[model samples]
Target: MSMHQAGIIEKKDFDVKPYYNQLSSRTTHLKDIFEIYYRYEISKEEKFVMTPGFLNFQDIKKGTVLANSNGADVVADHASRLFMPLYQNQGNDGFFAVRKIPKSFLLVSAFCRKHRIDKLLPLLPGISWKSKDKDVLRVNKRVARVFAKQLFHLMGYRSKTWNKEYLEVRNREAAARYNEYQNEAWFRAAFE
Candidate 1:
C-alpha cells in the first residue's frame, strides 16, 4: 500500500526500526513502508543522527551572488521543489550512487576517508574482559553507534557545498590544536 510521504524521515535520519517493523506484507514497496514508519512517530529505540556539520555546513566563495532580485523566490522555490521530492527517493531500492558506491555510504565514507577513520566501521574490542559472555560486544556496539554520526559527518559529502583547499588548510591548523584530544580518544578507542 502506498503511504503519504509526509510521515517518513528524510534521507539523513538514521531510523531503522520503525520502517523495519511496519511491513504488513513482504511485497509492500520500500518507499511506502518508510513513509508509514516515519509518519507514525519517533521511537525511543530508533536513533536519529543529523550532525550539525551536515545541516549548517556550506562553502561560498567571495563575490558569490546571494542573488537579490524578484526572481530569488522563484529560484529558491524551484530548487526546493526538485530536491524535496527526491531527497530520499532518488535511488533504486533506497540506494543512490554517485560513483560505484551508494550515495549514502559514499557521503559518509568521504568523511571517514578524509579523517582517516571510518565512521560506520564497527569498533572491535582488543580483548574481552568477560570473555564472549557480553562485555566486549557491548562496548564495541556502543562505541560504533556513538561514533557513527561523527564519522559519518567526516566522511559524508555536503551537497551544494565546497570545501576548498584554503579551508582544508585552515581546518588542518585547527585540528592540530586538538591533536592531544584526538590522540586520547581515537588512539585509545583503536588500541584499547
Candidate 2:
C-alpha cells in the first residue's frame, strides 16, 4: 500500500484462508460493480469515496467533503474502490467493461477497512432538504442483495450489466410532479 498522508484510500490483502474455512457458500466482495440510478460528482474511476462516519443508507450529494487516509478533505469523487478478494476472472466478457480490477481496491481497502464503518452514515439532512423516504425494499430477492449495488453506483460502479434506464415525461401534471421529484432539494441532499 502507498503511504497516503492522511486521507488516501489504501488497500490491503484480506486473508481469505479463514474466510474460506468458515463461510464456504457465497464469496462476493469488491470485484463486483454496480451503477447509480443518476449521476453525482463523486463517481470517479470506478469507485466512490465514502464519506467518513456515514452509513450506506443515504445517497451522496454535491458539496460534501470526503476524507482520505491523511485526513485531507477532497470533494468526494463519484466512485468507490471495491474489494473482491476472490475474483480474478477479468475476461473481455467481464462486467467492468474496462481493465481488470484496479489494484486500488486491494491497496486502499487495507487501510480504510481498519476503521469501523458503523456510525459513518445514514446521511445527514441537507441544507436544501430532508429525506423522509422509507426503505423501498421488496420481498425482492431479485439479485445483488445488500446496499452494495447502490453504493457501487454512487462510487465508480461501471459494468456491462448496469445501464441508466431513461424515462420520458410528457403528461402536464405528471411532468409537473416528475419535475417536483427531480428538483426536490433532496436531489442535493441525501438518499433514503
Candidate 3:
C-alpha cells in the first residue's frame, strides 16, 4: 500500500512547472535594489541645540543676552554667526548656529578617508595617534600652536573633549556605518 508500489516513481519526479515559470516571469533588477540602498545612504547632520533658544532664528550679535543661566543673564561673549534667543521656559541652550558645507569639502573628505591619510596626523608637531588603530588623535594644544579645530574637522575628526594636557578627537567616519554596504551584493554587482 506504499506510494512507491502504487506506480508513482517518486515525489522528486514532479517538475513543478509553475515555479520555474514564475521565476522566468520575474526579473531581479540590481539598479532598483541599489536605489533603495542609496536612499538609506544619505548622510545625517549633528545638530547642537539648546532648549531655551530652541526657536530663535535671527542673527545674534556679540554680547547679546542669550538666556538666564544659573540666574545670570547668559550674554553672547562674542559675535554670533547665528542666534537662538532663549524663549522657552524649561531649556538649557540659548541658541545654535548652522552653516552649509560645500560639495568640494565632502569630496575631499571622502578622498582622504578612502586613502587613510588620517594616519599621518601623528607626524604633526602636537598630534599623536591615541591607539594603534590610528582612529583617534590626541592633540597637545601647546605644541599645536598653529593648528586649529577647523583643520581637524576638515579631516573628519569631530566630537572633541579637552583635558588639561590634550584634546581627544574621535573620527566621524568611525561612527558612521557606511562599511555595512561594502560587502553588499547590490554594491558589488554594480561593478561587475
Candidate 4:
C-alpha cells in the first residue's frame, strides 16, 4: 500500500517511508501519528494558522481562518465541532435568511437581558445565599444549576464554579471591542 493511502501525509508524495521513519523515531511510545502529520502539514501552509487556545465567537469573522493542532484536547474538540459543519454536504436554501436587525445588536440585547437576570437571581424566591469566610457568596446550587450557568453560556459568557458554591463568569468577547458594544441601547438600558 502507498504511504499516502496509509494516511502518513495529507498529500500524496513520491516517497513516504523516509518521512514515516523519521516521525516514528521521534516518539518513545506509540501515539497517534496522524496528529503529528496534521501539525507538520499545517505549519507548511501559509494561509492556515493555529491558536494555542480555544476559539471564541469574537475570534471568528467573515474572513477569519483558523487551524488546530493536537496540543490541547479541549481546543481540538472545540475546533473539530467548529469545522465539522464545513465538511458536511448540507444545503441552506430555506433554512436561513438575511437578518433585518444587525447580529451585534441582537447579541448585545441578549447580554443585557442576561446581566439583568443574573442580578435579580439572588433576590428570587427559593434562592438563598450565605457569605463565606472570605466574603464570597455561596449561592444555592439548586438555583445556580437551573439558571446561571446555562444562561451565561447562551449570552456568550464562560462560567465556572468554585467548590460548587461560587460561580465566576467572564465575557467571551474581545476586550478591545468592549467599548464598541457597550454604547448600544440595549447595553445601556441594562448596565447604565
Candidate 5:
C-alpha cells in the first residue's frame, strides 16, 4: 500500500482489541509478531520510516527496540544532536557552514528562551514588558525572516503556495513507502 493509504489508516479511530487478542492467541511471543512486521516494513527501499503517529512511552520503547534490531538509528533528541556532527566536521570551512544555522539548534534555542521567559515571569514582574520594549526577543532580522524556511527545509519539508495566499508545507520524509511509490504515476501526480 502507499504511504498515503497507510496514513489514512492511522487516522481512523478503531479498537484493535479483537485483532490484538486473536493475534496474541496464535503467537507464543507477541512481541515477535511486532518485530517481524517492523522488519518487513523497514526492509523496503525507504530511507526512513516514522512511527504511525505520536506514541506513548511503552510504544516508544517498543519502537526503539525494533529500530535497533533492524539496524536503524533512532534519534530521541533530534533538536540538538541531529546535525551537530556536520558543524563539528567543518573545521576551517566552518565560516561558510555556520552561515546556515542548523534547524535543530534554532529549535532548541527557541525552546530554551521561551522556557526561561516562562520561568522568569513570576520572579520578574516586568520581564515581559522589558522583553518587548527592548526588543530582547528579536534575533538577527535577516535570520528571523529566513529561519522558518531554513528550519522547514532541514526537516525535509517542501512548501507550495495555493491561491497565492495559503501556504502548505509537507515533510517528504514522513512517507514510509516513499521509494516504493516515488516513480509511480499516481504518486507523482499527487505529490510532485
Candidate 6:
C-alpha cells in the first residue's frame, strides 16, 4: 500500500484537512490561521504587553520576549505562528498560533469517516484505540513520525504526549460535553 493511503504524509498531502487555509489564501490581508498557546505565568514581576481587543495572528520568534508582567521578562521559548495574543489578565491561554486549514481537507475527511474508513486505522502497526468509544487514539513514536501532528490535527484530533512511549490523540469535536437531556421535554421547553 502507498504511504499516502496509509496515513503517512505531510500536512499538504493530507486529504482530510481544514478549509480555513484555502479561503484565507484567496483573501488579501486576512490573518485567519491560528493555533493555541497556553499562557504560563512564571513570575509575579512580569508585565503583559498585549491588551484586550488587540489584533491577533502576530508571528513570534523563539526566545523573543513576549511580556514583562510583574517586573519579570516573559519570552517565547519556541518559534511558532502566533494567534490570539492574550490581552486579558484573567485567562490561562496567552495566545494561539492559528493557520488556515483548507476546506478540501474537511470534505475529504468527512467522506472517509462517513464510510467508516477510520476503522482501518487500528489495523496499522503501533496504533490502537484507548477508549470504548474508539475516539481516543494511541500511536507509538515510529508511527508518530510517519504521521505528523498536523495530520491528526487536521482530523479534528488534539494531541498530547503519552508516557513518553506513545502519542495520545483525542477528537476535539468528540470531546464536547454530553447533553443527555437534550431530547427531554423539559430541556426543550427551557430553550423555547
Winning model by lDDT: 6
Clashes of each: 9, 47, 1, 0, 0, 33
Q: Which digits, one per residue and each the tens of the lDDT, describe model 3 over residues 1-192? A: 133323344546755566646654663321121100001111133222233443323445777765544455656565534433434443444345534456777667667766777878888788898888666899997864567776787688887888899998999766656576557554444334
Q: Which stretches of candidate 6 lie over 4 Å from their true place?
A: 1-28, 31-33, 37-54, 59-64, 76-82, 102-116, 177-192
Q: What's the TM for model 6? A: 0.56
User: Regarding TM-score, does 5 or 6 come out ahead?
Assistant: 6
- Candidate 4: which stretches are off by over 4 Å? 1-111, 125-138, 170-192
Model 5, position 53, has a per-residue lDDT of 33
- lDDT to native, each model: 0.29, 0.31, 0.57, 0.40, 0.35, 0.63
Best candidate according to TM-score: 6
On residues 39-151, what C-alpha lDDT tens digit does candidate 1 reach at each position? 11223443322212211112223343322223231112111101111123122221111112345655554445556553223244421222332211112333433544334
| TM-scores for every predicted model | 0.17, 0.17, 0.49, 0.29, 0.18, 0.56
Error of 5 at 164 (Å): 2.9
Query: Sorted on TM-score, highest at the top, how do the candidates line up?
Result: 6, 3, 4, 5, 2, 1
Candidate 6: RMSD over Cα atoms?
Answer: 13.4
Error of 4 at 48 (Å): 15
**Stretches of model 2 off by over 4 angstroms after superposition:** 1-98, 126-192
Model 2: per-residue lDDT, tens digit, 7-108? 233234344456554544453332333432322332223333334454322334554554332344545344432222112323221111112334666344
- Cα error, residue 183 of model 2, in Å, equals 49
The superposed Cα distance between candidate 3 and the true structure at residue 172, in angstroms, equals 2.3
Write the candidate numbers in order of decreasing lDDT. 6, 3, 4, 5, 2, 1
lDDT for position 153 in model 4: 49
lDDT of 4 by residue, 1-192 (tens): 243643544454466678668866864353421111012223222232344343211223333334433442113322221221122223321111111334555576576655644445447754433433212234455656667564554444453545554455544442226576566554566554
